[model samples]
Target: MSVFAVEYVYAADTEEGRDTHRAAHREWLKGFVNEGRLLASGPYADGSGALLLFTAGSEAALLEELKQDPFNMQNFVSGLRVTEWKPVTGAFADYA
Candidate 1:
């Protein structure tokens, strides 16, 4: 599996929508966490976006999984980027 850095850019004026769906979003994440696919995830302090680290067999597989995210399903995420990441050092370096 490869590690990926997933960046989610929230749509403008969607704070309320996010709040409404936050519980479902977290519930969805728990399944991945239990499966060891999600490494870490959190919103930016500025609330513009969020960063999520995940492990998947391929980018396509990862995207398929992300399509099910409550935020994405609700259109709260306006932009998304998935990049393969190699953690050369730090807590994630073991993935390297």
Candidate 2:
């Protein structure tokens, strides 16, 4: 499996839409966390975005899974960026 960093950027106007779907979004993420596909995830301190760390067999598979996120389905995401990550040190170093 490869680690990936997924960033979600939200516009100011999306707050209301995000709030409406927050419960479903978190619930979807909870399943991945329980299955160990999701390592870490949370909103940015500035409330403009969120970061999600995940492990998947391939980028295609990762994005396929991400399509299930309510935030994406509900169109609450203003921008989405996905990158394969290499952790050379710290807690995630083992995954490198």
Candidate 3:
């Protein structure tokens, strides 16, 4: 399996827009974490964006998972960036 960093940059306008879909969004994220696809996730203090760490078998797999986010489906993100990362030594070193 591989490890990846998936960032969901929320649109400030979308944050307000997200109020319409917050419940579904939370439910979707909970499912992903339970499934081991999401290693970590949280919002920026400014409430304008969020970061998501993913541990997937491949980049394609990660994209497939991101497609499942309710917020993404609702176009609540300003942008989404996915990057491959190598964890050399740390609590997450075993991730890759």
Model 3: residues with Cα > 4 Å off, grouped in runs: none
By descending lDDT, how would the candidates be arranged?
1, 2, 3
Highest-lDDT candidate: 1
lDDT of 3 at 68: 78
Please report, in order, the local distance difference test score of every candidate based on alpha carbons: 0.96, 0.90, 0.81
Per-residue lDDT tens digits for candidate 1, residues 1-96, read: 899999999999999999999999999999999998899999999999999999999999999999999999999999999999999989988875
Model 3 is weakest, by summed lDDT over 10 consecutive residues, at 8-17
What TM-score does candidate 3 get on C-alpha atoms?
A: 0.85
Instruction: Please say which candidate is ahead in TM-score: 1 or 2.
Output: 1
Residues forming the 10-long window of minimal summed lDDT in candidate 1: 87-96
Residue-wise C-alpha lDDT for candidate 2, range 1-96, written one tens digit per residue: 889999999865888889889999999999998998888999999999999999889999988988889999877887989999999988887776
TM-scores for every candidate against the unseen true structure:
0.97, 0.93, 0.85
Ranking by TM-score: 1, 2, 3
> Which segments of model 2 are wrong by more than 4 Å?
none
